[model samples]
Target: MIIIYYKNRFISISESESSTLNSINIEFNKIHDINIEIYKFLANNNIKNLHLFGKNPEKILKKLKKSFNYVKAAGGVVVNENNEILFIKRRGKWDLPKGKKDKGESIQITAIREVSEECGIDPEFILLKNYIDSTWHIYDESTEFILKRTYWYTMKYVGNEELVPQADEDITQAKWFNLHKLEKPLNKTFLNIQYIIELFISQCK
Candidate 1:
C-alpha cells in the first residue's frame, strides 16, 4: 500500500481495499492520468479521503510518478538521553526539521545536515540510527505539480545542546518535548509528520 498526502487529506493506493464508506473508492485504469485525477480529487472540499486499488498497485505508483516533477527530501526524528523528542515550529505549525536534498548528496547525509542546520545541533552529535520510513505529498509550485518524497531517519542526539531554530527558515522555535507530553504538539503538526511519529512510537512498543 502507498499513501500520498495533500494537506490534511490523503489518497491511498493498494492492491486491496482498506478504507471506510465515506471514502471515494475506485479501481485503477491505465487510460486516465492518475496524477491529474488526484489533483482534481484534492480540489474538492467534500472528498475527505480516496482509495484506489487494482491488481498491480506498483504499476499504478509508477504511472503516478510520471505526471509530476519529483523532489527528494530528508528529515530526522531526533531523541535525547532524557527521552525527549525534538520539534520545530515553522510558520506557526509544529514540524520536524527537514530540507531538500542537494544534488549528488546522499540521502543519509541530507537527513543529518538538515537536522543539524535547522536545530542548531552539531552534525557530529546527531547520530543517525536507522531508516524509519518515507512520506509523500503533492503540492503546486511555479505552475507545476510537485511530488515531494521525504526520507525519515531515527536519530539520537549525543550532546546536550541548546536549540537555535533557523530563523531565516521561518522556524520560530526549536524545543524538545517529552514522549509522554506530545499530544498538543502533535495536534499542530502536519499529517505526514504525525504519521511518522506514530509509526516510530508503534515500532518502539
Candidate 2:
C-alpha cells in the first residue's frame, strides 16, 4: 500500500508487494465518483515510479483515449579542471544547471547550452562518456504534470571565463566545490543527481 498526497489530501492504493503500476489512466467518469479533487485523483492513481499527467479532468480523459504523450528533456552536470563540480544556488536549494532542449539541438548541445546559460562559462573541454539515469516527479506550477526525462552528462570545463549565474533564471549564485567538501550538500541533492556524481567518481577509480 502506498499513499499519494496532493493538495493536502491522500489517496490510498493497494497492490501486490512485488507489483508496480507504471502508468494509469483515470477516466473523468470514474474520477468524478472518487470523491477527491481532480488533482488529487490523478496524483493518487498515478502509476508508481512512472509519469503522472494532470490537467482538466475532462481534457485528460480525452487525451487518454488518444494516447497522447508528454515529454520534456533537460541536461546538466558540470565539472572543472580542478576536479570540482560547478553548482548553483537557486530558490535556496543547491542545484546543477539544466533546462529544456531547444528544437533542432542535439542533447549534447543542450547540455553545453544549459551549463553555459546558467553558469556563464563555455565548456573548454567535454566528454560524452556516460549517461545518468532518468527520474520522474510531479510538476504543478500551472497544472500538475511530469518532467518525463532529464538527460545528464558529465562535462569538463576548459574555458577561462569568470563564472556568472543566470540571474533571471532564479539562479542566485554559482561556484565550484572540491569533491572532498561536497559530501553533505551532494547528499541532499535529488537522488538521481547524487547517483550521477557517485557514478562519475566510481568511473574515475
Candidate 3:
C-alpha cells in the first residue's frame, strides 16, 4: 500500500481492495481519465482518505506522481547508544533532520549531510548509514504546489554532542528524546514521520 498526500486529502493506492467501500474506489489505471472527478471529490467533499486498488500500484503511483512538480529529499532517524531518538522542532513540528538533495551528491551522503547541517552535529557522529524507507507528501507552498519524496535512514549516534537547531531554517529546538516518552513528541509530528519511524523499525530487522 502507498499513500500520497495532496494538500489535506490523501489518496491511498493498494494491491487489494480495502474492506470499507468508499465512493471513490477505482482502479489506479483509471485515475487519469477521471482526475477531474477525483479532484472535485477532494475539493467538494470532506473525505479523509480515498482508496484505489490495482494490480500494479507502484506503477500507477509513479505515473500519478508525475502529474505535479516533484522533488527528492533525504533524512535520518538518529538513535543514541542509550536508545534515545534525535528530533528537531522545525516549523513547530517534531521532525527529523532532512533537506533537498544537492546536485551531484549521492542520496546516502545527502541524508548524512542534512542531519549534520540541521542539528549542528558532525556527520561522523552518526554511526550507521543504513537506509529505511521513502515517504511521499504533497503540499501547497504559497502560490505553488509541491510533491516531496523523502528518503529516510536509520543512523546511530555514539558521540556526546549538544543539540542545536538551525535558526535560519526555522528550527527552534533540537533534543534527544527518550524512547519511552516519545508519545508527546510523536504527537507533535506529521503523519509521515510516524510512518517513517514504523518503517525504519521494520526494515532494521
Candidate 4:
C-alpha cells in the first residue's frame, strides 16, 4: 500500500486498488477526495486549528516552523484616465479585479490578465506599476485545508475604450467610482479592498 498524507489526513492506495485507479497517481491529484476525508476526520475528532504537512516528520516540523496563521494573496487597484478607480460589484459587494496566479505566469502577468478578464479591458493601454501592498486573510470555508497568499498592485488605465464586466463570472457590473463616492461604498466593501484603496489615495497625495 502507498500511503500519502496532506492537509492532516492519511490517504492509502493499496496495490490491490492500483488497477482500479489507473488514471490517478499522486495524492494531490485527488484533492477533492482528500478534502472530503479531511473534513470527515476533523468532524469526527472535533479538531480545530489543525496543522497539516507532509508525512515526513522532518518536513512536517520544518513546515510548521515556517507556517503562518494566515495566507497571502494578490489583487489590484486599477484607476482609469478620468482619475476614477475601476470597481466591480460582485456578490453584493464592491470588489476589485484579482485572482490566483496560473502555472508559468508571472505576477505582473497575473495582475494584467486578471484585470482584463474580470473587467474586459485590454492590457495594451494600461500602465501597471509596482506592487502596492499585500494582505493576509484566513479562508477556511471553501476547503478543508490550505491557506492562500495574495498580492496587490496598482494599475493606471490609459485608454478611452468602453468598459465591460465579465457577467458570466459572478461580476454583475464594472464601472469607475469617483473619489468622493468611493469611500462610503468601499468601506462597505471587503476590508482588505477598502484598505488598498485608501493606501492608493494616500500615495497619490
Candidate 5:
C-alpha cells in the first residue's frame, strides 16, 4: 500500500479499500488526465482522503507514474551506539539524510552515499541493516508536477565522527536525538519522515 501526503491530507493507493472514512475513492486509470484530476482533488479542502484501489496496484502506480515527472530517492534512518537517531535540519525542517539517485547508481548505494554526504559520516561506518519501507509524495515544480518515491533503509552508525551538516544542501544542523526523546524533532518533521520513523519503530517492536 502507498499513502502519498499533500497539504496534510493523503491519497492512498492500495489493493483494498482504505479504512479511512470520508475518503474520495477513484478509479484513476479510467481518467484521461490523472494529473489534473489529482490536482483538483488536492485543491478541494473538503476532500481530506483519497483512495485509489485496484486488483493490480502496481499497474495503477505505473499508470500514475506516467502522468508526472518521476524521481527515485533513497535515504537512511541511522541509529548510533547510544540508541539515538540521526537527523538533519534541511531548510529549517527536520529531515533524514536523503537525496536523488545518481545515474546508474543502485538505490542501496544511493542511501549510503546520501547519509555519508549529508551527515558527514563515512560510508564504511554506516552499516546498512535492512530495508525499512518506501514512501510516495508529489510536488509541483514550475509548470510540471514531480512524483518522488523514496526508498528507506535502516542503518547503524558505528563511528564517532564529528557530525557536520552539508551546508550546500541547506542542512543547518546534524545531530542525534535520544530515541526516547524524539518529540522535539518529530514535531518539526515532515509527515513522511514521521511515518518512516513510526513504521521503523513498529518493526522494531
Candidate 6:
C-alpha cells in the first residue's frame, strides 16, 4: 500500500476497502488513468482522504504527478548522545529540520546542510549516519499543486553548542526529546512527519 499525504488529508492506495467512511473511494484499474475529476473531487469536498482500490498504486502515483510539479527535499532525524531526538516547532507544529536541494548538491549533504541551517547547529557537531527512508506528500502551491519527495537520514549530534531555531525560516523553537516522550509532540505533528520518525525509531529498536 502507498499513502500520499496532503496537509492532514491523504490519498491511500490499496487493495482493501478503505476504513475511512468519509473518504471518497474510487474504483481504479491499471488500464484506466486517474483524472482531474477524481483529484478535484478530493479538493472540492474538503474530504479528509481518498481511497483507491483495485489498481497498482505505484503506477498510478507516477501518473498523478504528471498533473503537477514535484519538489525534492532532504532532512534528518537528529539524535544526541543521550539518544534524545532533535526537533523543531515550526508554525506551532512539531517538525524536524529540512529544506530543498540546491543545484549540484548531493542528497546526503542536503540532509546535513538543512539540519544545520534550520536548527542552527554547527556542521562540525553533527555526524551523518545511514539514510532512514523517504516520504511523499502533496500540497497546493499558490499557482499549482506540489508533490514533495523528501529523503530522510539518521544523524548523531556530538556538539555542545546551544540549539537555535531558524526564526526566519518560520521555526519558533528547537529542542531534544527522549524517545519515549515523542508521543506528546507527535500528537500535533503532520502524519508524514510522524510516519518518518516512527519508521526510523522502529529500525533503531
Among these predictions, the greatest TM-score belongs to: 1
Q: Model-by-model lDDT, in order?
A: 0.89, 0.59, 0.80, 0.62, 0.88, 0.84
TM-score of 1: 0.93
Give the worst 10-residue stretch by lDDT in candidate 6.
29-38
Cα lDDT, model 3, residue 84: 88
Q: Which candidate is the best by lDDT?
A: 1
Show the colliding residue pairs in model 5: none
- Per-residue lDDT tens digits for candidate 2, residues 1-205, read 3333322233233322223345443434344434344344455644333222343534443333232134545666666678788888877777777877788888778777888888887555544446764433234556444434467777777766788999999988888889668975585555556656787678668
lDDT, candidate 1, 5-68, per-residue tens: 8878887889887757578887886447676677778678678778888999888877878877
The order by descending lDDT is 1, 5, 6, 3, 4, 2
Greater lDDT among 2 and 3 belongs to: 3
C-alpha lDDT of candidate 1 relative to the true structure: 0.89
The predicted structure with the larger TM-score, 3 or 4, is 3
Poorest 10 consecutive residues by lDDT, candidate 2: 9-18
Model 1 worst lDDT window (10 residues): 29-38
- Pick by lDDT: 1 or 6, better one: 1
Candidate order by TM-score, decreasing, is 1, 5, 6, 3, 2, 4
Measured against the true structure, the TM-scores of the candidates, in listed sequence, are 0.93, 0.64, 0.86, 0.62, 0.90, 0.88
Ranking 3 against 5 by TM-score, winner: 5
Off by over 4 Å in 4: 1-73, 140-146
lDDT of candidate 6 over 30-94, digit per residue (tens): 33547664477546657777777775667667777776687899999998989799999987899
Q: What would the TM-score be for candidate 3 when compared with the true structure? A: 0.86
List per-candidate RMSD values in Å: 1.6, 7.4, 2.5, 12.7, 1.9, 2.3
Better of 2 and 5 by TM-score: 5
Candidate 2, residue 60: how far the Cα is off, in Å? 16
Residue 65 of model 4 has an lDDT of: 26
